[model samples]
Target: MRLTDFTELMRNEFGTMASDSMLRDHVLSDLGNRTGAVAIEEGVDPREVWLALCRDFDVPRDRWYLHPS
Candidate 1:
């Protein structure tokens, strides 16, 4: 998926508190190795690997720590 799509997905899934830096760090720290492996094995973009993760995890695109009142 595109970066915009991924960004939107992350915003929804992890909430507004989850900044892009946080997401990048989390992905690198948690899924970097596995994602790299999968990307290499599947010949897909690393970004796609991350997208698959969000999709597989059923992460919402609008997850919020606190719903607006």
Candidate 2:
């Protein structure tokens, strides 16, 4: 997915402030223990970062992919 899509998904799922905090502070093990923003800057896939976030936060499996109502 594009970076824009990743940004929107993060905001949609975690609110603007929380998403920003996570991207800045949450270290993702799957990305070599790098924060989301750093990992993305180093060329990690946003989808991979999102999945790592979901795993770290224990987000429900059903919610991994967005579903329109």
Candidate 3:
């Protein structure tokens, strides 16, 4: 799938403020599932997915560890 479509799916699935740790866990938990089911579906490394999320949301990588709920 296209990056834009993948990004939108990430946003929709995770919500606006999905925590980085949560994202990490989500990806890990679903690692065996179809690639399209995870955020980095297009062979993007999980770290890259987290970095992209941090960049897009303007959240510092360090701050992403804090629990949002």
Candidate 4:
């Protein structure tokens, strides 16, 4: 799961919009608080971030593999 994959997940769920960036930023920031390791600072695993997002938002498990690439 790359950043592009994560962003694509956001687009798939939320549709295309500039607000997607804000949503991503907000989620990532909150993730840092919850995990105690900022992704950018320590290079968090993308799969971990994705799983955390899914758990935090209750996203459907079916969509978990919807990442395009």
Candidate 5:
């Protein structure tokens, strides 16, 4: 997914402040122990980062994809 899409998903799922904190602070072991921001900075796909976040935090499988509008 595009960075914009990833960013929007993060905000939509976690709210702005918490999403920002997670991107900065939550170390995603699946992404080599890098925070979401760092993984993205190192060229990881935003989609992978998003899924890692979901798995790490136990976000429901149904919510992994964006909702239909």
Candidate 6:
């Protein structure tokens, strides 16, 4: 999904607190780790990142671009 969509999902899932930069990073790290996407190299795929976050956070699968395992 697009960055905008990801941000919106964050807001929807976490409310206004999601916009906090530090909290955002914490969330990313938590989700990234769960999907083994922690490397986060330059060539990392956005779809994979989105999938990781969605799966890790239990964000309704229907709202995600990729239904992560």
**Residue-wise C-alpha lDDT for candidate 2, range 8-60, written one tens digit per residue:** 88898899999999999999888898999999999888888888998998888
- Candidates in order have lDDT scores of 0.48, 0.87, 0.48, 0.59, 0.92, 0.51
lDDT of each residue in 4-63, candidate 4, tens digit only: 777676667657673254344545545656431255346776666766766666778997
Model 5 residue 2 lDDT score = 87
Point out the worst 10-residue segment of candidate 2 by lDDT: 60-69
Question: What stretches of model 3 exceed 4 Å from their correct place?
Answer: 1-39, 64-69
How do the residues 10-36 of candidate 5 rate in per-residue lDDT, one tens digit apiece? Answer: 999999999999999999999999999
lDDT tens readout by residue for model 1, 1-69: 444555565566656665454444343334444443444355555355555555555556454222221
Candidate 3: residue 11 Cα off by (Å): 12
For candidate 6, list the clashing residue pairs, or say none.
none
Give the alpha carbon lDDT tens digit for every residue of 1-69 in model 3: 345544454565467565434554443323443232254645755445544555555665564442221
- For 1-69, candidate 6 gives per-residue lDDT tens digits of 454555565566657565334233544553434322232343445465655666666778777644232
Candidates 2 and 4, the one with greater TM-score: 2
TM-score of 2: 0.89
Q: After superposition, how far is residue 66 of candidate 6 from its true place, in Å?
A: 5.2
Instruction: List pairs with backbone clashes in candidate 4.
Output: none
RMSD to the true structure for each prediction, in A, is 8.8, 3.3, 11.5, 4.4, 2.8, 5.4
TM-score of each: 0.40, 0.89, 0.34, 0.56, 0.92, 0.45
**Model 2 residue-pair collision total:** 0
The predicted structure with the larger TM-score, 1 or 3, is 1
Cα RMSD, model 3: 11.5
